[model samples]
Target: MPLILFNKPFQVLCQFSPQEGRESLADYLAIPNIYPAGRLDADSEGLMLLTDDGKLQHKIAHPDHKEAKTYLVQVDGVVDAAALARLQAPLDLGDFVTKPCKAVQIAEPAWLWPRNPPIRARADKPTSWIAITLEEGKNRQVRRMTAAVGLPTLRLMRSSIGAFSLATHPLMPGEFVEVEAEALRVGG
Candidate 1:
């Protein structure tokens, strides 16, 4: 089985399946016999994993593995400390209590590539940056977590998944790379 690391772009579905009137894995990934290990939402962007190995996919996608994932989130509000603190604490999502996670404020930088369709800008209001890390990724967890605490995620980008990081390789929108399968092994 071979492993591939990709920095997915905005509006791209995480699968090869056809998305009506929308972009999907087919638009970006050309490698044969590879499938996404997990997913990043179509509206969200950043590090994605692909592999031909079923076991590897399960190891990365299954919550039991508790593999850490990190994201750089831009929120609509100022995202005060109180909100940031709540992100680090457990969240009650009705079905279950989310595990504690990590979050911190980050200064804005000009290095990130501009999202193809940029988030709407509010003249009076402003955007803020937050770095969030989670061991278990629930559906729209980061977005939901932020929304629960009064800040809605305006934009989201997964910077890292387990050992692989986008900062190191620097994937522009719609670009990806194939890494040695062993490089993505959790405990190799």
Candidate 2:
């Protein structure tokens, strides 16, 4: 079985198949039979895992597995302690209540690459970076949670999922590296 770690770029679809004019993993990945373990929205960027093993994919993607996914978020405001607290608490996103997770303000990571086309800038408002870890992967959950707490997410990047991290296996945007399948299995 093949396990690949890819650094997904902004505006790139998560799947390996073609998607009209928009860019997809096919543009960068040509490894047949491997599919993305989890998805990142077109607007989001960073580490993504791909695999041919179904069980490993399930272990990585399933919410019941409770594998923590860490995101480095840049929001459009100075996030105070109160705001961080709100982010750490169980947030009600109307459709579902988010499970309590780790949220902390972090200095910008040096490894980060500037996004192409760039995030919108506000001459008056400032931006802050925060690291948030969530076990449940809801659709656009991080963005919604930050917005609910009065901070709008400007950029979101999944830096790690469980023990697999972008730091440990570095890949620039649109680049990928293959890893052993056993290395990714939970507690393997």
Candidate 3:
């Protein structure tokens, strides 16, 4: 089965079709027949898995499988111990409560690429980096959770899904590497 690990860039749509005035996967990926197992918002950047194998795709993307997705997030304000505690706790997001996940303050990753339109910087306000790992994929969940705790996410990038990490694979934005489907295990 054809399995691909793609480093999706900011402002690039997750779909493989063309979109007027916006970058889509078609701009970078020419490989046919493979579809994204999951989605990353156009504003978020990082590792995405694509595959032609339906079974493998379901295993990777389905929330029931509980594959942990790790992100390197840059929030607009300083994240103190209290904020970090809130982040690690199960958060009530109105529609649903987020599952308890790992959250820790981390130094900015030196390997991260700069976004084309840089995130807005406030001269007076400070920014901080944090690592968040979640087993469930929700729509703009990370952004919303941070905002609820008074730390708005400025830049969000998913660094890994399950055991497959962008750091280990080392693909630049819009670049991809193909691997055998069996090489990856769900929830690993």
Candidate 4:
């Protein structure tokens, strides 16, 4: 069984199969047997782990394991400390209250690659970046959380999962790398 790390690109589906003429995991990864440990939405991009080992997948995806998933989010408007603080607290989302999470502004640099189609820019409004981490994997949780805090997410990317961080292995949109099971098993 192999443990793999992928730097998922924006608009790419997490599954190996195709979707409605759009890109899928098949296009980026050729390895067999390994499946995504968890998932990143089609609209989001960044670090995703894959494994042929079912137990590893369960450990990573099961909410009870409480694996922290980190994301780099670009949102509409200039987010302030109050909004960041709100994100750090429990969020009432009507259906359920989100668990406490970390949120902080990130420094911007010109080196950040541009999205293929690019995020929409509002002439009258500004945008900001935020780094968020969550233990639970709810559908579109980061985007929803930002919206709940009066900040709409313009772009979202998962930067790291557990001990694997995109910082150490920066990947272009669809690139992936194989990892030793021993490496991933350490932090979990």
Among the numbered candidates, top TM-score falls to 3
Better of 2 and 3 by TM-score: 3
lDDT of each: 0.85, 0.89, 0.90, 0.86
User: What TM value does model 4 have?
Assistant: 0.93
Each prediction's RMSD over C-alphas, in Å, is 1.5, 1.4, 1.5, 1.7
User: Ten residues in a row with the worst lDDT in model 3?
Assistant: 179-188
Runs with alpha carbons beyond 4 Å of true place in candidate 3: none
Worst 10 residues of 2 by lDDT: 179-188
Whichever of 1 and 2 has more lDDT, that candidate is 2
Which regions of candidate 1 deviate over 4 angstroms? Answer: 185-188
Instruction: Sort every candidate by TM-score, greatest first.
Output: 3, 2, 1, 4
Model 2: lDDT of residue 65: 76
Clashes of each: 0, 0, 0, 0
- Compute the lDDT for candidate 1: 0.85
- Report the error of model 3 at residue 109, Å: 0.5
TM-score of each: 0.94, 0.95, 0.96, 0.93
